[model samples]
Target: MTSSITDVAGIEVGHFTDARRPTGCTVVLARGSAVAGVDVRGAAPGTRETDLLAPQNVVERVHAVLLSGGSAWGLDAAGGVMRWLEEQGIGIDVGPARIPIVPAAVLFDLPLGDQRVRPDAAAGYAACQAASRSAPAEGCIGAGAGAVVGKIFGFHRAMKGGIGTASVTAGGVTVGALIACNALGDVVDPDTGRVIAGARTEDGLHLLDSRRALLRGDAPRPMLAGSNTTIGVIATDAVLTKVQASRLATVGHDGLARSINPVHTLSDGDALFALATGASGRTPGMMTLAAMAAEACALAVVRAVRAARGVRIGELHLPAAGEI
Candidate 1:
């Protein structure tokens, strides 16, 4: 019970954080490769190799999944992951070479950090070197280091977001989620239906409740397309086909909908990747797996905002959930 995605067998987690700025990348490695699929729910997304995960694609497995900061430029980090996996002799064995399939997604964090210092190939390799079966460090680290949420009002009023993980076991199978939440809307507690972290009021002393503001006709501050996003991975030990894995990823969005108000908006790029290692060798009921996926994803999302630490860079300040 590490309560982490690592709790799922055959899954390893790692991070590479840049001290120069609050931007980095997280890698979910399945060295042995695993059946993988993805669902991109938001209108704007920055990703690589996602099409290969489609059911009709030739590739049926992936060596690693990457969640990163620095927007689209961060996609370069995937190259490093491939390099590391190749060194381990892990990947699809084609006639000519063994190519590691590394799919990746990136979120917008350019404004909070030194945009020029985005995660590069070397950074990805470093993250792979740091990979471990141990529970990963959460909040204000890795890809979520510079994450911010509740931007409907504007960045100045937004709160800090971060990476979080949660796992659930049912019928001898385990499902887990690791989320880097950087949304354009507020985070809400699913149980209480209450806003936990979001845009601040005019005084910057209270939660503005983005959902309520929308209903009350508060004109939201306009944001550039693809300026925010929530990216994550869902892993399970149960046996699943590529189609099932994709469905799991799609249902995983229900978890996001439950905890994040006004999610899947045009300004946010929300994506989830599902990996089934089949370490348990159990073909559990699809309904059971889907329920667990959503539950774990929701828990991880809430934890992300709660575990986050406030950010203060010069005049810019993004408070953690508890800070207010």
Candidate 2:
């Protein structure tokens, strides 16, 4: 068991990062296409081709999903993904050419990284080119490269967030999640309900609870529009319709709520995509798969923090688990 999203057969993972800018993109690919669904919980979301994923929509599957940083501008990564897929002759055949169905989501990392640098077509293509089924390199990579948590207390007090992945096999089926942990609230351990990664005091010595700070009416720093978002993708080999896949994406949010305190706020764009490869002809049930997917998501959240590395962002340095 690789314990990663790629563990789900028929799916591959890849990343393209700009270390200097502290921004990047992650690509989840299904060369043969995969049934896909998406759920967006946060008020501010930066996405591409999400409407088609709705059960009521026409597109039933997507060839790839892109998770990127750069706010709306990062969406250009999807075009790159499309170009790559088109070159490979992947997509819906509509007469003369095939149009690859690629959906995408983005997070806010500009406040923490080089605001001038953002993911683009080249980055998306690079990520697709690097697609593989091996266990992904977690933390401070891909879209999570510039991610930060506990932003409620403000950027100065926030902790570094990054990409994390988890997977589990149950009832002869595999469920997995790839999480980019970037929220306006604190990250808590679901089991203990204790703050694991969150805002630090102005003195940079102790962890501060976001809810507590808000309750006490202590505001730290403010941000611009689209300054925060958390995005991810959940995958399974079970056979499920678009509606079922969409429902599973909802369940995946439970995993986010478990690990991140006060999720789905107006400030954070919390979103997840559900992909069913249908490689396994058998499944315990949609509910069972959803529950497992939720758990896997929570696991990915913690792994991201644990695997993160300290990132220096102008005057401030956000420490990872080891540094903290």
Best candidate according to TM-score: 1
Question: Per-prediction count of colliding residue pairs?
Answer: 0, 0
For residues 88-129, write the lDDT of model 2, one tens digit per residue.
999998898899999999999887756889999999999999
lDDT tens per residue, model 1, 200-293: 9988999999888989999999479899999999999999999999999999999999999999999999999999999999988889999999
**lDDT comparing candidate 1 with the true structure:** 0.93
Worst 10 contiguous positions by lDDT, candidate 2: 219-228
Cα RMSD (angstroms) for every candidate in the order listed:
0.8, 1.4
* Clashing pairs in model 1, backbone N/Cα/C closer than 3 A: none
CA lDDT, every prediction?
0.93, 0.89
Alpha carbon lDDT of residue 110, candidate 2? 84
Off by over 4 Å in 2: 216-222
Show model 1 residue runs off by greater than 4 Å.
none
